[model samples]
Target chain A: MGISMENGLSTNKSVGKQSVLFQNPPCVLGYSSIAGKKEGEGPLGSCFDIIEEDPLAGGKSWEDAESRLQKKAAELAIQKASLQPKDIRYLIAGDLLGQLIATSFGIVDLEIPMFGVYGACSTMGESISIAAMLIDGGFADKVIALTSSHFAGAEKQFRFPLDYGNQRPLAATWTVTGSGAVILGSPKEVKKLPEDTNPTIHITGITTGKVMDYGIKDSMNMGACMAPAAADVIFHNLSDFDRKPDYYDKIITGDLGYVGADILKDIMKEKGYDISKNHMDCGVEIFSKETQDTHSGGSGCGCSAITLTGYVFKKMIQREWKKVLFVPTGALLSTVSFNEGNSVPGIAHGVVIEIME
Target chain B: MGISMENGLSTNKSVGKQSVLFQNPPCVLGYSSIAGKKEGEGPLGSCFDIIEEDPLAGGKSWEDAESRLQKKAAELAIQKASLQPKDIRYLIAGDLLGQLIATSFGIVDLEIPMFGVYGACSTMGESISIAAMLIDGGFADKVIALTSSHFAGAEKQFRFPLDYGNQRPLAATWTVTGSGAVILGSPKEVKKLPEDTNPTIHITGITTGKVMDYGIKDSMNMGACMAPAAADVIFHNLSDFDRKPDYYDKIITGDLGYVGADILKDIMKEKGYDISKNHMDCGVEIFSKETQDTHSGGSGCGCSAITLTGYVFKKMIQREWKKVLFVPTGALLSTVSFNEGNSVPGIAHGVVIEIME
Candidate 1:
């Protein structure tokens, strides 16, 4: 019913990504943080030190909190990108609010063009995917993709109150406490990438899922709702591209955790395809259930975003891995629907990440 | 500080638009559909009217509503532009969710190269501006920009009840109910635009906004927050580029109404500039407060969005106005900060639109 090549996928991952690194290597030129709370090791390695304990979330008024977080993220991101605030061509961001106030309010200070987007907790992937394409497609010289969610704050609007004694669901994703942003740009004046390398981390294709309800619904859980969308993209990528599960070293889904990942695999196989090999998920890994007790697993727009920026890409650049598919999954279920007897629906998008050869 | 154009003046006008015939120019092309609610009038003006009723505030479900709205908007936008959806090289859209969902889920049914983007409410402007640049830059043959909002669905998440007996500040604005989608391409193809002239929407330049609060106190009133950004760009356009507001027939701010518009005017004056001769705000006009009972005025990422597609650009083509400045304003407040008690900060992007003479 949609775009189809031979088998039926809409994206191309066969391009030699190694060659992209030199010309459009899709490098994260700038990385910065105006953090609210640093939980896992201070530097993300020590998993213990409180790198900085600035408290914008608690003390600031609602509007101030939104501005502070966005400003913090923007300052760090712009500095990292080394572009004047006005030099940025676009700012693509979203937040967990009724109007995306935090991201938009914050951008007022950055003075860069912006395109506010939303996809719930899966926003990081959506943001990065678009930003990468903007750079790759030459629509922009540099772009930024960002998303954030507040734990205590969002819990009230999205589902239950943190102070509520309700039982948590197995597919519940832990909302992230802080935000992260990155600057995307071509291999402009700064240095040299392999002149003729194919690009890595380019968003080659996209598939949006229908918000389907199966009748079994939960508010706190999102992985289940997002499974079908993940499967749709993964299956489409393989089927349309005529690739096998092992074509890449990894096929990772953003914030799907253990439950959602398993459901996605089952769904894909149910349609007579297998994506089991090297399949990975971000949600299942971030939190130590034993230590953190994030019921099913940690979930947030950041769960996938931070890992991709902090761990996945860095590891890829370090040559620990060659190719991986990053798919951020989001549940399209809102609180009203849950209260209205509607089961949640899910959608996901996939991007291939490879180290420059 | 955040945008500082607010002089706290009000300029309310009840003048109805000049009786004008609605026309779709040929430089545009392509159409697609979402869940079914559809975009625009859908060849019949009935849909947009329906959405205009009992509009959502927040915490409403968009899964069902957006599907119909986005799909219809895409279909008509493409149809109005006189191009087929299959021919579009890219579809860029995003909102306050994580998956950039409406466009993603809505676009999945349409076959085309797609890139989802998010930049909060400034999304539509940012998307269209990028598309115009791409067409002018020759990176794309055709691009689509789409966005929509549901009043019932949104109200459930953002604020208390419309009946909750809460008072809205003067700077508050209402979100528009309809989805706005645009198709951009070379004026040469399909001879869609007039044969003698190039398209009027060739983007010459775009300026982004930043995150600044200047201690904006109310999250609900965004026009107040974002007015400064609008002024910053208008001033920059005048001083930085040595251009004046009169270079265009009219200068449009995406959605600032009586409050923000007044603020923008004052901000420009302080900056030793002026744009009052032909300044207009889409937010104030898109929805009729006399009819809609919208207190302060219209707001939302899509407020300025539909105005550009449905109102301003139309006026530009008819020669009622020419050489326009599109500054889509966005309030960077979220439900979290509204809860946090943060004042909303806002941003606006300026994209000059002119047909090749």
Candidate 2:
């Protein structure tokens, strides 16, 4: 469908059912990823911009620590882009905390017009989609998309307290303690790369996901809960664009660990898409099963966020991976809802990022 | 600042600072407001579309009840719009719950691509702003903007359990149990009102807000916690458009009750705008101060939402109010944050609604 503006500009941005194809793709001017000590020791540890050895991040509490991490990442991203806080038109951010307290406290000091979003771990994708659309839609010149998660905070909020010494199932994934932020800009604000040899990254399109519930109720097995959602959106993204899985260099899922990764491939196979060869999961890549002993893998909003900003972007800038489909999956369940015996539904958002030559 | 599109259309949607002035405003296709028993007994009782006497809304738990309330409102709004769920391109909705369980569970059945947003109780305004922008930007033809808050559910999540029979502070505002949903559509989908005499309602502009903190720690006195934020946005909305208090038929606030209302007026007065005569609050209007015994007034995401869709929209249709600046204020505090001795910050979002000739 095409919409003709009163000014006589007819633009068709809506793609297929759930995707948006930007007419003027928004450029990723700057990006930053701050990781905790544990994530810094992971395989991709060296890619993080800042690695904080202190879990508290010099803050009073776990939530405060998470907030500090987010603030640091946001500031670094803006500084990298050579823009002040006032130059950012909007701050689209969120976390795993209730009421988005982490974001409310973290970005309050920055004082940018804010929009708090929550989609469990998929927040990074959601924020990027909204920010890109806002820029492409002629609403703003520059916008910040950010998200974070803390191990202690997520455990206290979602599962048992750390002091309780609770036992986790093999399917459980560890929440990554980190924050990632990116500054997206309009064409006018886009500057040439610091290194002329580097390729510019642009958010070309996005596919928003529907809540998919297969009636999975386990909070511990978040990957199992979120895997269906990941498969559904990946299928839709491919179908919406009428392309095969080989169209992109890589298709990455946010945190579908070892078990859920297998489930995701099975689901995709049933849907007639063979993504096995090029599929990758951030959860599986962040930690080594033999060395780290993490049952499933690393997971959280920060999982995919830092992976994309720190690792994937590096590959794209170096011309290793030219086009990528980044899909972040989220399990929608609160302690209250989980205890109430409600099913853990899942949602995933897909962002199409490609190197602009 | 104006953006010149590749299609040769130069549109200046950004107003002063944090506001956006839509070149092609989106129309409100339909709206629904569902209230609980307590709200049904209030002054705006007859205005609500449906009043569920059972706090559970026939669900087993408080969270489930709130989810059911949201589902009912969303369905009703779509039905009123003469559209199926399939017609909605996106659903921007959230509730005052951890992980937004209410929204996650409520709208899952709708099968629409979703974007969950949270701004405490100011979520209604945020959702509407996003939905309108998507429509105006040609990213979506129709979008559903929704939010809900339930007294019992909120009490459990943010305060004490209902069984505790906690003492009510005189300064405390009662959380309203209600849900409100509105379907915004592009001009191409604009249909004439059922009544030929009724004018069409359009979202003309929006003022997104920044998180404001004054170190207010009293959750019971949320009016004080949110008043400054409300004042900041109202001041910016007026300044951004270069308008005075008289420019709007009424300057309406979301849930700033008696205490916050006074504070808001005082702040605005100091800011060089005397809005004493035209200032109205949804919380103050929802209930009778003398008889209802709701200490300050009814306050929640639902407070401003229902008031707008029910009472405020009726008045606009009757020509009693031709233009309104609707601001929904939110005190950003979770039980965890409050327990941790963190300060309660606030945020508010403003939407400009006017009758189109």
Candidate 3:
């Protein structure tokens, strides 16, 4: 017979198997956000830790620019946590680039144990969930979860180059050039911190998402492609926890722009739950249409990541919000797959964060 | 205050804070492997579950052929375990292609909750480690860890297309066109199996690897690029567990091939432990020098995956070996990064598997 563990917390916090309710949630020790010029001009500009005016960020290429964003964000997060690079046991990171080049090149200097994950635009949520699991399961004491996306880099790889200047559809979303990093510490580790520190935000639970293919093949319209997946995860998270829309102070989605947000509301309405009143999307909140001229809004692995690190995280710390359900959605498709006539599939992961002050 | 319980096992199986020694390891219920024509003619040819003589495998493109390999392997693995698609709670998969298209397009029909991962050739070890952790942590009852790689597809993406006919260096390893899948189940789930089934292999522990860069810039020689990392992980595993090389019947490196195997031995020797006698590389064992033109032997995500599923696993089942250390090494460098003059970083994860009978 195998050994069984009740440990510090029972391992039976799973709700309906898709979600894990962490009995001893991991504390968010610190977080950092780095955004590009366009993102700096957006409404959440003042909240970012670093606003890089040069798209290249003094790097030789756009890919290298993204690497700089990741590096700065990670370094700043660790610094803010009053910890050195050696104190981190693991680094869970990813990016929108092929093979996660930005993350590999960015954090190579840290030399921490790395777990590279891919969830398209939803990588931030996936990274955070895995890092929390490692800490909650007692495998790690301190871990950092980070992701990044560069507009020029993603455009060159996934779509026409900047020189092409191809006109995008009205439903298309702009890839955010930014990076976000959050440091999660175990309770024992957090207890060693200074008593004058701010109250910590806890990741109480996570809902893993499945790839949902609604047979949408539009590569340009990522919001539409990811709406179904966002709806599915939102619906499942509520049903699994037996919660309603009002259970959370704010229900946040990664990128579903205005169009996709409406679509998600309709999808939820058909499922007997209406989330319209308390719904907010990072993509829609990031940019003001009148000034930004972004057709649909911002969408990328960095979109929700920076928003969380910059906006929601600060709100929770200031007691403006008690609880929030953060869902990051991803459109899982490659240019090759789209060129091959395959439809796009989408995925979304949900993380429940709460402040107990 | 956190909830505390001391029920069965302690959630503190960590060794030296770098590895996890599972108190209740997950069982390997079943595994399957599918290989291409070239691999079929290799030394371990007869051990594979299926061998597709045609490289195309009746598909329109090489990518589709790789997808077929994944589908066939997954189906056969589940069949061998007497389980259905619905029984699997998650599918952890990856490949050598950009964006993991081979895996996404390959296993989309299964509709399992997928955690797309990328560690290049070391993806197999990463996938298995995550799946085992999930099972041991009580997050899922059953999960399938799978990965694939195709020579043509990889060459076209990372190097030159098949039509280019580029001459490769002597140190260049051949990418193995194959796929492997392993079904991991919790103890309670495995206990429900029929009594007449063969003995199950248990994943007792895992040592997660960190990205190690030795400033190796030559992308063509992946074995040399990955050797330092292989040595780093092997050293850490030994130091963490306080065990010698003789602890297991064999210590297998994923795709170190002939050159890297020697380098790994020398590195281990300098660390005051000699692993020369017990070390075996999947890349070297998979192909015969005289028969196959693979200069340094086979290399790819499939190399170690198929070797583990087809060869080493059979030996463990028959009690030929009571225990083995499976280490898959990855060279993390994209063509874009390489072209930009970035050095290749390597990573290696060690998984200890033992027969529980």
Candidate 4:
């Protein structure tokens, strides 16, 4: 990767399209994942840094609980990086809520300058992408990317209240109650961990997704609404980088679940790239369908976030996967839009993470 | 503004605390503001690019109307910049809506890579801050910072439904029905207009704000809720840059109405800075308290946004005000948060706009 520099600034970070190849890749200094009771009982339960047994997270409301989850994850991530909140220059965060109430309340105590982003469930990817760009672009030395979602709160906001006892269709996915926080720093700022024998993870590049609307009006089947966007970003990420599917050890999608995952593979195949072999989805990997009864799998901002911070990062640190393209898909819809007969649009952001050489 | 370079990369963009003084300042190429009939009748009505008399903007719902407002402003801004939607690298946008449905649906037609941001009414500042950073950091050549707010939609979302005929408190401000879009580009990318000659406006520096909660639970009195935040950022910007308030020709706040403006001035005075001589509030400027019947003043993301794009930019181009510190303040609250007895927190971002020398 040749960096065309004039004076003291790199002029060519933008790739073919919808992607940025960082000249100075930002490293993931530390990360923490906090999960709820149901998530703690899932297959990747043990991977989480902290698991709250109480559904309300010792709070009065579900939104407050999610806020607590986010606060805990942020603090733990900072502690893991051996840094304080004051040391972080910026905090990029958002959640799937009206006006991002959860995020506004959650990270307020951290007192870091924040850029609130909304990409539905894809918020984690968006946050990380912005954080990496800020670091690589020399705007900040260290930044924290954070996001969270709550099952009960999401249901109340997007669907019926718990007292209504509404039945979900098979295509409806459960919103994961969890939060994930990652502390990213410039390569020079991150301290090399001597105790860890594996490799450090660096965000080498990113592919930002546009709003893709296939006119899918059914909010229950978010996988269908988001599959097209997931596919679009994934296709472009490969095309823009001129890389083959085999180039990466794993191509991970946030919460495509069983249905959207198949659709994504088919879409990629049509685009002449076969990602089926290496394709993995956090939704499908998070829980057991038979035991958990999570029909379409866990879906939310936390779905991919916790999976990445808890499960995937552990695997990467153990040298299981060398390179990964992590794509988080989001179904952009609100009760107001849906009630107004608006179609559910979807957006996805892709982050390229690789082990340092 | 000496930039210390390490291998052709500026490493000293970060200023004293929360501010970033850009070495290569990004220039504002073009801007557009779309206002509804009510805003069109306001004091700055003539400055708007377009005014839609129809409340719906030919759309069925208020949300759709707001989305249309965003779309029109974006397209017009691109056209004003003498570029197409394809020419822009990224779209930084958000609205005062749940899940940012307006933004998601509004700019989807533009098909640019988008980053949805939320800072309540302070979103214009947040979006522009990120957009300027992207250009200054060399991640993008051109970007559009966009935001919108609808009176009816906000009334329903935040306070009371319009149909309820709810009585408003004297301290309450009216939500502005408008949208503002600004096209910012690398100084090298923006084309100079020979037809008209004036100093080009450049985003020289930015001071990002942290969430400040004074435990003010009154949603109706948002002016009181956001004043502290507005004061905090202004103080930091002046302190970080080591300048007095008089360094700026005018210190402009987004929508801190008459109430908040007084509080902000008092706060600044308490901090050993008297800005009353050169302070201005968009809320107070946009409407007439006596004739408009607006209790406190105008408020919303669009209040400050349209004021900046339509009125302030025009004044700057006319050489009326040379340098200005534009601070947009946001009161972070949700209906749930308010109902749950949680206090409304405030955040504000400051952008220093100066005439290029």
Off by over 4 Å in 2: A1-11, A196-199, B1-11, B196-199
Worst lDDT run of 10 residues, candidate 4 chain A, spans A1-10
Interface DockQ of each model: 0.20, 0.54, 0.40, 0.55
Give the least accurate 10-residue stretch of model 2 chain B, judged by summed lDDT: B1-10
Cand. 4 TM to true fold? 0.97
Q: What is each predicted model's overall lDDT from 0 to 1? A: 0.58, 0.90, 0.86, 0.89
- Each prediction's fraction of true contacts recovered: 0.27, 0.70, 0.43, 0.69
lDDT of 3: 0.86
Q: Across residues A306-345, which tens digit of lDDT does each residue of candidate 4 receive?
A: 9999999888888899899999999998999999999999
Worst lDDT 10-window in candidate 2 chain A? A1-10
Query: Taking the tens digit of each residue's C-alpha lDDT, what string does model 1 give over B259-346?
Result: 8888889988788767888898876675555655566676665666666666665566577876777887766555656555556666
Per-residue accuracy of model 2 over B71-147 as CA lDDT, tens digit each: 99999988888778988999999989889999999999999999999998999999999999998998988899999
Write down the TM-score of every candidate. Answer: 0.77, 0.96, 0.95, 0.97
What overall lDDT, based on C-alpha atoms, would model 4 receive against the true structure? 0.89
Q: A1-357 in candidate 1: lDDT tens per residue?
A: 122332211223211111011225455556444333533532343321122355455445443454456567667666654557655556778765556665655566565556666666667766776666556544455677777655555666676765677777666767655666777665442333332212343333333323344444766657777887777777766664556778778788877777888898899889887778788787776666676767667566656666665566655655677777777777665555456565665656666565543
Please identify model 3 stretches exceeding 4 Å from their true place. A1-11, A192-199, B1-11, B192-199
TM-score preference between candidates 1 and 3, better one: 3
At residue A226, candidate 3 shows an lDDT of 89
Residue A286 miss distance in model 4 (angstroms): 0.8
